[model samples]
Target: MSLDLGRTASPGSTPRAPGRLGVPVTAAEALRYLTDLGLWIDARRSQLSAIDQAALNAPDQGDREALTHDLTVSMALWKAIADRYELLKVAFDSGRVGPTQAEQISTLIWGRLDVTPGQAGEAARSRVPSTADGALAVSLPEACRLSDAMTSSLRARLALEPTAMDVGLRVKSIREGIERIRDQIGLIPPGASRDKANHDLVGLEQRLFGVTERAKRGADVGGYLGPLEVDVAGRERDLIVAAARRVSGERDAATARAKVADLAARGDAIRSLQAQCLRDVTPAPKLGVPDVRALGAVPTDADAVDAFLRRLELVSRALDQAHETYARALAEREELRGLLGALDAQAATSPAITEDERADLAPLHTQLVATLASTPVPLVRARALMAAYQSYLQAVTTNVRGPR
Candidate 1:
């Protein structure tokens, strides 16, 4: 059920002038202009009909009466123009009117049109004598112009344009905007900035109240309402930006606090490992572990939080280096102990070693065992002694085998 309204004019045809108070110089132009004018009249009639219905349904008594009176006058004026246009169109379409007659008909468009008795009587009573029979001396174009002006005013008054919101809807929207701004204002910390924002909001609320009052009285408050809406919108935007910054700052602070706790726990674990390493391994790397508690609690300010996070990163790196140093020292100590024990077992079990070699190896093995068993063992000395013990056992084996 779709309908194409068709194009306004034929392709390649120049647009006709709007309802001007001047006649076309040629008959063809005049006929074309008349056809376009008739189409315009039809469209205007439909628009007026819709407006008439809206006026009848208006809730306000004063608005309905005022709108209905204006619509009546406008429709009457439109009828006079349409009737004249119809007469000229028929005459021209008959194919009998010559250039001279067409010129005469063109005068009807640029000349006065007929008026209703009410208009004629008013004109007559006013002593203007502008009407002959029932026709007024106002040109058709002038009549159309008057009707157009009235129609525009009516549309604006009724909020009939597509982009024009109803008064109640606009008021509600502004109120909602105010509430949103209020909520954002609450997010602002108590400071000079928040106070200033509150001041601006108060002003906007006052302006809104004035606009609402005018609207209730049926006054055209559009001029007042528009600027208030812009101010409210602009203020809301500023408050929203401020609120977002505050939330971001709080989030960063929370994250920094969590990081502080994590780094503190890690520092304690690294210290414990360092103590163990000191007890078991001599000549350990003397790296100092940083005390994360010295950095203190995370700050509330955004800039301070950033600085605190950087400090945490440095502390974390320090802990990593210290942990690696201490853990590696412990690992080396355990590795040497395992190696020394394995070599001693091999020598005691080997059949290549005679009883005399066993007596030779026993004292050196006892000294190596005492060195490993000592707390905070001297790693460098332990390694040297283990190497000597292995060499002595290997020599004893070679002697037992003779020339292998």
Candidate 2:
């Protein structure tokens, strides 16, 4: 297990508070700052719990007693800070605090708080003692500083000369890391890279063996063990990264190949559509359907494969645009055919047209039909002719109706 002592005080010393706590300009500001302090206190309480548990499990009697004493003092200091903080928080939360209330809150934050029973007033008058039994008066920040000092000291002692269990756990972890790295090394291809990585792993393994032996002999192997663990972990990371890159490169190459095949199919379909549009529709767009084969085979190198994929994407987009243009042109031609048919049918059944007028319009309609039905129909000319025919028919209808 790992302990994260967040924002710890500097090693071997209690943090000193400022000459005086600065009063917050507003109650809300005070509340915000206090809220943050409350979170820090909560974190410290958790750390103290872990430390207490570790102390209870301490193998040596002397170490256990010393840790117990430290834990007691730290807990007491924490309680002092926590108690004062809760009170100040309630005052601030009441929403009635002004400049005077702000000053009082500042005092509680920075001034020594008396935690001694039955001596609160006397403790305020006399110079406060730091002993565990006497009038223990410590400000919120001061209590934190003192608690941090003790926590740091205990943590340092444990780290410098960890118990047999700690040593065993550490050794087991390092061994596991070495094994993982060795497995990762097998993934590297047979080349200078693999050989060099294998050589580095051998050296780390030797160092780990030596450290394990020192730990067996009950020596302080922390110095050797810590660095060896770091080295092994770093090598593991490097090998994992290399393996990831190789896998990624393989996957990218496969994707690039798949994209190429798909684009080829699309290009073929687009070409067929283009042919049809050119044969049947006048003024068809002449955009070229890109030949994906021109991009060549996907390269083995990662960067080259990436560039290849980018080009494939461009080709795919161009194919899409070309396909859309041709299909739209063909659709428009069909639409014009439908419109012409509908108009001719309307004119034939229209009561406004006399038999003599129908005879006169019949040849014009036939000529329009022939032009529209011809291969490579001219869209511009078709539109103009349709418009003129519709206008002439409308004019005859209007004349028949006579001033509607």
Candidate 3:
């Protein structure tokens, strides 16, 4: 829409932030509005210029009152629109429209409306759409498209026209593709081939970012976009191809490496547990656990590595069982030893004890000694020895406490 150039800005009208304008706006929206406005003004430049000249030239008395008033309003409106366009253009070129600039823009476009001397009259005659809701609704990409079109139209007005380009959309699509490729790369473990692919993709992203920056600076990016898009597509294809080749090797190797690390940890744990078991056993039986150090050498082949892992698993399970068996038998043996110690103490303390007491205690003490002397003492035999020893001690105590 045309702006009113004759309308004087409000006396106290200081620039305000876009947030203060009570409208939501993104960088794209500002760009679009500015671009569209510029093109619109350029389109009506001749018509507007003629109306302005005629009003200026016409006599005050015979100035065709209707034409005079129309020309005045049109000139005022065109100027206002142009001023807004310049404000937005500067903001757009910066590639960023922070809240404050955005607010200034919205206020300039929709907040100030006193373009004509007679506000009431202008309001009655004007049919311009209220920008209250419009500014906040426009998005950044939409803003870019609008701005790009305006740039093209302005250039055309001077016969220096440039081809239109949708650089924003291309850049956006390429970026999305890059992100997807990155996610795929995450699934594949790091390696030489993947690193090379990643390096190439990174370079491509930088080039695309540059293209976007050039577009923001009002460069004719139409030619640049095509080559960049092709490069992005090709790079994306190469990345996928690269990932495909390396993924199997990297993933398998990664998985194998993980298995090897796990096996190593498990082997250390099994060895520790095996040592514990040997210590618990009566004679510390030789743990037949194949040397854990031998498994440290991982094979390069996937199947061979997998087989080695299986062997480790089997060894771990056997060692675990050995630990349990030895620990149980050890607990029993310790209990039997305690009983033997009690019997020997009682025998030594009571030299005057009767023959019957000695006979009963002798058999119990013999059983305890036999059980303790046995290598890798069996849990069942040790339990029986402890029971017998307890019975003998209880009988002797009862006899000593009898009426005699």
Q: How many residue pairs clash in each candidate?
A: 0, 0, 15
Tens digit per residue, CA lDDT, model 3, 1-404: 23333433321111222333457566766655554554555654554454445546556654345445444444544555555567666655554667776666666554533233233244323322112121111222222222222222222222232244355755676676567557655755567756876787788778877888987999976666655555554444344333333433344456656765765576566667666656555455555544445666656543455465566667557656656655555565676677678767876777556788788778767867876776656556667777777776766665645455
Those runs of model 2 whose alpha carbons end farther than 4 Å from true positions after fitting are 1-168, 189-193, 209-221, 241-255, 299-310, 355-367, 394-400
Residue 9 of candidate 1: its Cα lDDT? Answer: 30
Residue-by-residue lDDT tens digits, candidate 2, 116-235? 433333322222232223445445664564455455445544553345547777778667767767877888889998999989989998998898888789899877865665566546
Model 2: how far residue 133 lies from native, Å: 62
- Answer with 1 or 2, whichever has the higher TM-score: 2
All models, RMSD in angstroms? 29.4, 22.3, 24.1
Per-residue lDDT over 114-185 for candidate 1, one digit per residue giving the tens place of the 0 to 100 score: 565364234222321122233334456545644554565565566565656687876776787788678778
Instruction: List the candidate 3 regions with Cα displacement exceeding 4 Å.
Output: 1-321, 346-353, 374-382, 399-402
| lDDT (Cα) of model 1 | 0.69
Name the Cα RMSD for model 1: 29.4
